[model samples]
Target: MLLHESQLAQGVFNLTWKVEMSGTIETGHVKWFNDEKGYGFISRDNGQDDVFVHFRSINSTANRKTLQEGQRVEFKVIKGPKGLQAEEVTAI
Candidate 1:
């Protein structure tokens, strides 16, 4: 297989680094949601299973207290210790 195709299949080149510490309203599916805890994971575009997003990262302007599972919303990635985390979640 071509390297590009392999990369695409493996979702390696798709990794995101938050150079700007900010991002546009790129949407992702909510994988699991816990309204009581106010935290959840989003299924990112590159097929990642779960990217953690806390309520604190959600924008107040969003006007939503909690997210529903499978809901698509835009967010930014913040570098975390083990991997990456989604932040600044906002509806678009």
Candidate 2:
């Protein structure tokens, strides 16, 4: 995200820079998940906004891919249509 500084010196000024990379891997815990619905949100360890997670994004070897509440996981963050989403999620 780009951050702006509006107050600098006597005149208004703006400064911005990239605070995070687009493909950074993040660690978090499953805030809530619905096995039937196949979707959930993760509470990021870094304290950023929770990231949306879909069943298809999980890395699993079993027949069913699901996450439990408060389950630890690692994944890459990406910009989804609605907002930040978790991809390649793996239980850790």
Candidate 3:
């Protein structure tokens, strides 16, 4: 089946899948982070919009990982309650 057709089928059945049909995985820079609050915003290089990122979404191998301002990162944008939020964030 074609890609869009398959997606339409899934939508009809309410069967969600891990697919990149909507938004894209993008690269950006950490605009700022509040370690105390554990939340930050990323400046998207695509120039679409700034995405909200929480420390919990960060992918790190270290015991203590914190994002620094102006750090390059990669992430996927997902729909959040407030709007678009960043997920699976990682330092580049």
Candidate 4:
């Protein structure tokens, strides 16, 4: 055997972008929902992928009444665990 050594890069190759939004009331209908589990998907404009929203993160009371199948409300964009959860929801 022979002595051997090597050096590797010391910095991370991390890349990320920021979510900036002064949100306003927007209409989004519930695509898939489980009221009992307090988790569901909302289909936004342009027909993009539905974003997941959890009851634990909502400012309103943790109940299905605070949300509905086709509710229109205003909220800010947040980088949540499941990605892009609505915050500070208020009726239009």
Runs of candidate 2 exceeding 4 Å displacement: 1-21
- Candidate 3, residue 87: the lDDT equals 84
TM-score of 2: 0.75
- Clash number for model 1? 0
How do the residues 1-79 of candidate 4 rate in per-residue lDDT, one tens digit apiece? 5433332221121113224343554556655557788776677664655666666535665444346777655555555
lDDT tens digits, residues 1-92, model 3?
Answer: 55698788867654333333246679999999999899989999989889889887899998866899999999998766566778899999
TM-score of each: 0.62, 0.75, 0.74, 0.52
Error of 4 at 28 (Å): 2.4
Root-mean-square deviation of candidate 2? 11.6
What alpha-carbon RMSD in Å does predicted model 4 have with respect to the real structure?
A: 10.4
Deviation from native of the Cα of residue 18 in model 3, angstroms: 12
Root-mean-square deviation per candidate? 12.7, 11.6, 8.8, 10.4
Specify the poorest-scoring 10-residue window by lDDT in model 3.
Answer: 13-22
> What are the lDDT figures for the candidates, one per model?
0.71, 0.83, 0.83, 0.55
Model 2 worst lDDT run, 10 consecutive residues: 10-19
